[model samples]
Target chain A: MGQEMSKIEEAKNLTQNQILEELEEQLRVEEIEEQPDTIKTEEMVINFGPQHPSAHGVFRALFHVNGEIVTKIEPMIGYLHRCFEKIAENRTYAQFVPFTDRMDYVSSMHNNWAYVLTVEKLAGIQVPERAEYIRVIVGELQRIASHLLFLSTAGLEAGAVTPLQYYFDERERILNLFEKVCGARLTYNYMKIGGVRADLPDGWLEETLSFVNRLKKTIVDYDRLLLGNYIFKKRMKGAGKISAETALAQGLTGPPLRSTGVAYDVRKSDPYSVYPRMDFEMVVRFQGDNYDRVVIRSEEIKQSLRIIEQAIEQIPDGPILAPGLPKDIRPPVGEAFGHIESSRGDLGYFIVSDGSLKPYRLKIQGPSFANLQGFPAMAEGSYFADVVLTLGTLDPVFGEVDR
Target chain B: MLTSGQLLEFANTNGIPIWVLDASIALLLSLAVFAICGLGVIVLVYMERKVAADFQLRWGPMHVGWRGTLQLIADAIKLISKEDIFPKNADPWIFRLAPTVMFLAAFVGLMVIPIGPKLVVQDLNIGLIYALAIPSIGVAGIIMAGFGSYNKYAMLGSMRSAAQMVSYEVPRALSIIGVVMIAGSAKLSAIVNAQSVWYVFLQPIGFVVFLVASLAEINRVPFDLPETESELVNGYHTEYSGMRFMFFLFAEYIAMMAASALTVVLFLGGWHGPGPAYLAPLWFLIKVFAVIYVMMWVRWTLPRFRIDQVMDLGWKVLLPLALLNILITGIIMLL
Candidate 1:
């Protein structure tokens, strides 16, 4: 065992005893399960999802299960691949904003901001005061919408059917607010190269303030329905405990990483776009388990509400777009990476401009893709039902994962 | 209240021919049961959907009929009319026989279920035992479907049902024994009559054990690990479609009705409510629906348990609890 630990240490380049302890614990579990039973049961190879009800969307997980515990995990993804990066290279710099909307469709506002924030940074276009505030309001509202969905799906995948309805009801109202703002429900191409497509509609800020007040109550409703539910809590707590080291090593961002006691939110740590002005707390938990992740999302929803409240009050009136910004957005021949603390994680976009109308190459630093690297690690020894909850807690939108 | 036998006697005394009378009695009982099953399914399915919608904060099926009253009928027509697909490499005999076994188990259990004192199809002395044993027959059908389908998911689901059913049967039956002991008969009608103070008060622990165990036996969540739709994608009945799957669905709902009916008899005073003597059947159905409501509420509210955790719950917690209930009953009886 000591020799095996040393070999692993040599391979992994780790000096700490934590890895060895985790390995030892895994071995103990294996030994316990392998202890001879009256009727021996062989391991079954099971293909879960791509079409699975609880798989968020289009995630295929091939697992070898001993009764219910997942022994081997081979996660088969790319079922929702739309080739966003490839599309980015083909289209003009400003034309690809719609494509970004589809990447994380639940939080399309954030996706648009991530992409445009990069383009704005790359081309050195100054977003007007009103545009930044609108961006914050829209982005934070989208975050609330995204987290609301996360809460619903997490509860649903864990077998509670009621929370999804409540969450969706709340989400629909947010979407209504979104529609009022942009005249689009899902994929809003509302963000342009330098600024928002338009200013908030008449009384939009007042309406948004009212929405924040309403959302405070709805958020509590979600907490009551799901957070305090015994079966939900029992199913979530200690189900998918991922360590902070593995999370960081996998380049994880967002709630999946933050749940492991690391408050590495790009918005806070690496402040971007109007986030410095919006004062709010970053939610974090120590366990990095399913419960912690769920709690983190719930807490973040509250913080987002706070930010929205502040944004609405502090938002200034000015031009919704940068003045003197050319319509034909062609950045200089240079590479620039722009990232923001999106609802999911540090949603980043990297673009290489060739001094042409279109970008030469574009790379999407999607959080879902990065966070999904920790899935096989988390699901390795957990129960089959626990695997569903783990996937829910991880909350990988196939739009982002397979983009 | 004319029993089936008395109705036969009346037919014989009347100018009706012997063959016609015999056929009529049999046909009447069969038709009556079929009507109950069909109508029960329609009402219960609608109730379940509405209840689930209410729980989830959405309006259930509301387009087909007034509030989608005809939704189940449409579903039935579709299911019945749909193609009966036999999976390639399926063991055709067992696959075909599976739904029948499940359907008949549920249907036959209805024979012993007493809606009123004389409303039972065949109130055999061993009605309670018969009710218990009949449901176990469905387990074989579950295993057969799992085995015969040759689909890994179906097999996993069936195997889960096998393990779950076997483990839960002990507690399920044990909990019922307290009721049977109090009644001094396995006859379900007698058991109902025996409840003067309503055995639920005397055997609260027994009622809890019975409810929990029966939920496991019927594959309700958090005991529904076998047919976990999220993990197993419809469980043992995954490969089934059209009418065959409908049979499986019918069996599930019928079994739920049976469990509820049995609970009403054993715990709540059966068919004894605040109404006229003739309203007993209505009261009976109302109680059954109430029980079904709770089960469905639990189904939508609670998450599924891990397989091992479910086993631990059944054996370590439920089994011992059931046994303790029996011990307490015995002690109280002696005192």
Candidate 2:
């Protein structure tokens, strides 16, 4: 046992690719061994989605179960794929901002910001001070919206209906605030290559401040209703536990990784936009269980509210769009990658420009796609009900995952 | 005042043949009971929707009839007019018969409940036990539905339903034994007559255990693992549709009513409210609906418990509490 522990510790120092190769080798060797002639009953294999209520989207998985205990899970994704990265290569840099909005539709502001930030880095365009503050405000507002959606759906998945409606009421207010700035509510194509689409509308700042103030009180009520619920805590506390080593090995980021005490948020670590100026702590919990994942998101919403409040107070007056930007953005031959702490995790965009109107190659590192890798590890050997809870806590939007 | 026995005697005095009168009276009695239960289901369905809407901050059933009073009737019409679909591989007979069996289980229990003085459909010598025993038959119906559907979700749901219902029955029955012991009879009417002090005050533990166990038996929220929508889609009724689906819905509401009625009879001093003797049935109904309102309140507020957590709660918490209540009741009776 001591030798096995030392071997595992040594293996942690290896790269992810090397670990995958070793895992494949181990599987090959195990497959060649003879099976013992032991009497066993047939395990039921259930296809749990593509059209399930609690599946979050068209995500599907084959769950192999012994009665109610899930022994193995094979996650099948790409149902909502629309060749997003392929389309990005054909469209010009400025034309692709709208496409980013469709990636993580719930947090479109963050998606737009991440994409534009990458293009800004590639083009060497400088964003004005005021535009940076607006970007920060909208990004944090989008985080609150996305995390509220996570809490609502997580509650719905757990069989509590009231929280969904209550939380949606608050989310509707946030969406209205978004609509006031941009013309759209869901897929806000508001973030430009160097700045935002427009400045804050008349009284928009006051409306946002009022909404943020109201949410502070409402979040306390939500904590009493959902986070403090005995049944919810009992169901989620120790279920779907993922160790910190397993999380880091799986390349998990954002709240799912932070819940395991990693504290590696892109906003905190990379310090993009005005995040370094704002005063807020990265929400982290030491338990990598479903309960911690949920609680961390709830706490993150509070922190997002704090960031939004500070950004609103500190926002300066300036041009919303970058000055002297050409209609067709043709950057010099280069590649650049920019990441943000999206509500799900580390949302990054890598753009390769070849001194043309269109990008040579564009890749999206969607957090949901990476975060989904940790699910089977957490779900195996748990009760069948906990599988749904684990999936809810992971909060993978199929649009982002399959993109 | 208008017992079926009195009506039979009046028919005999008029020189009617006994066999003809008996058949006619039995048919009429069954029809009356069915109408009451059917109407109760409609009201309960509307009430559940309105209550849920109220909790969720929405106006429920407003467009159908005066604040959605006729919404269920419209829904019933739509269900009856729809195409009846069955899974191709499903067992045809059991698939068709499951809903009927489920509905009849609750219907039979309803017949034995003493709504008023001389108001029961058939107050048997063992009315209390009959009401408790008959509803357990619904577990068989749930199993049949799951087995016949040929779908894994329905199969899992039915297995959960069977386990939850069976495990809860022990606590449910044991909890009520305190009432039976204190009343010195299993007949529901006699039990009601004996509740001068309202057994809830005397046997509070038993009342609470019975309430929790009955919620599990009826598959209400927090114990609604059998048809947990998030986990099992529609659970045992995944393959049922059209009028067949409506039957399962009817059975659920009917079972809820039966459980509430049983709660009223056992603990809440059935028909003993301050009113005219002729208004006893009204008092009984008031208490029954009150219990049902509380059940719906709980359903919307609480999230569901997992299968194992539900089992733990039933066997570990509620069962022991029920036994202790019975033991305490026996000791008091001896003193």
Candidate 3:
């Protein structure tokens, strides 16, 4: 039994990159021996994106293909860059909240919360209990909305059109809820430095509770519609596999890291907002392949619903915004970092204050940027179709990736 | 009721020259086939959109002529009016010829189908083999489009289509063999006449194998790797435009009709429903549309399989099942 345990441990310790290297070496030696000069094949380098469908946005990659198999991948980014950080330097701390919304525009609420959390930490502002609870509720709702987009796009990349339409119905409802709360759907600048922009409107809590309850039932239908499908599972099962160490080393967070069984969520490891008070399991899967990465997001949506339900029940009646704050408030000369578990991954904002109204230097550590680093590694030596599937599973929003 | 032989005899009675009569009859038959297939393509396109919309939870093409009935006509006009573009480095002759070859290949397959009693263009003795063999010619057109386009995505799409079509032809042919053995003829009309009980009942496994392999053969979803929109953009026809692009679209829907019609003849007892002889074509069309509807339903509901997985299913699973189906049919015949 001890010998078997050690053997299992050794197998688990084998890095994915090492295995890929060994396989490539074997393939290389075989190809060198078998090839004849008369029938030699040349590798074709094809540009996969920048204007392609299923790119999610204006993301580009060069794929070197031998027949249908991809031998190498080179990712090109920054086409959607809008000089967000540079613009942040010119604006006041309060004025910068709206700028963060455009970073990861799909889940703008989470971006809003992450930026505000950094500012709150830097300015030493205290948020009321009710505001934290409201933040948690909206943040969890944004997570669900973001994940719904991911699932729909993933379905589309796999060539299933019905799931995209079906999942969008649910995402539209979530967006409607956001539109009601913040008066803007796509870029909700609802979070302030110390609290939320406003309290729940009449019957808002009941409506949110109803939405979660309805989603909990429909998500099962979604699982049956897309996730439980035979062809979908076959497409995803062993494709684009990465090991736990490789995932962590690539700085992957959220579902991508959790898929490798790392169990490292920013909300759980370092508690934020009302997350510590909420009872929910950190969703994890062990395969770390495209399938697990997708499945983990569905599981996380369930957990997010759990968190929202708990927050709504525990919310206290208090102030929405902090009292006695200056209109153009300045922070002391110091640096502060705040991270949140956004829909895609760990979204963090780092601020360097110089006792001025505007930030001296502001940096956004976007999870999409970091998660995309692992894509080429996973995509190498995969089939051309699997490369697209792997990119869909990674779910990098280009707004964040090129921010 | 007007067979080609009756028309030729009528021309002979009128003292018309045989050669001129033959030429005119050939022209007339070609025009009739073209007209029927053209009308069929428009209806199939509209039906495909409506069916896809129904599955996708939206109103599809509602503004066009009463729930998108005239949408395809509008599309046809648009396609006809568009500029025909040839890429700078494209091989003009091959690029120009590809869509025609593809359209003709699919078009000719419909000539052999027995829509009603004595209604076929030419009920040749080798009709079954001809229908199967002719559509494979479309692969050549696909390869030509890919090679002549000077585009990498088109090249990849064409290569994938060639590989997929070639691989699927085996199981498709094998699956049909069980029905051919029981029917005792390769002529499509004879085969349909042999089905007192539909072949789908006795050859259930063969029916399934034929359905799946034919789906792959026609390049429907779940097996649509050649023109995977997300992965390959527009695939082989990426650079095709104007009437040339319309040819590819027309060929696809016609090919879909041909496949579904062939499925009806082989399995569902074509033109054999309880009805008058005048209504036989209607019954045949109803069966054809039913099968086409199922194909569209599957297309919307399922995601595509990766190329390797598709090849695996074709070779490892369906091939063996098809062979076993033949084996079982032969054993029962011996008993």
Q: Which structure among the candidates has the greatest lDDT?
A: 2
In candidate 3, what are the lDDT values of residues B184-235, reduced to their tens digit?
A: 9999999999999999999999999999998998899988888998989989
- Tens digits of per-residue lDDT for model 2, A289-349: 9999999989999999999899989988878788999988899999999999899999999
- Give each model a TM-score: 0.91, 0.94, 0.94
- Model number with the top DockQ: 3
Query: Candidate 3 lDDT, tens digit per residue, A163-273?
Result: 999899999998888888989989989998888887888889999999999999999999999999998998889999999999989999888989999989898899988
lDDT of 3 at B34: 96
Tally clashing residue pairs in candidate 3: 0
Candidate 1 residue A379 Cα shift, in angstroms, is: 0.7
Q: What fraction of the native alpha-carbon contacts across the interface, defined at 8 angstroms, is recovered by model 2?
A: 0.85
> For residues A245-295, could you state the per-residue lDDT of candidate 1 as single tens digits?
999988888999999988798888999777888778888889989999999
Residue A86 Cα positional deviation in candidate 3, in Å, after optimal superposition: 0.9
- Candidate 1: TM-score, chain B only: 0.94
Model 3 stretches astray by more than 4 angstroms: A1-40, B1-15
Better of 1 and 2 by TM-score: 2
Docking quality of model 1: it rates as: medium
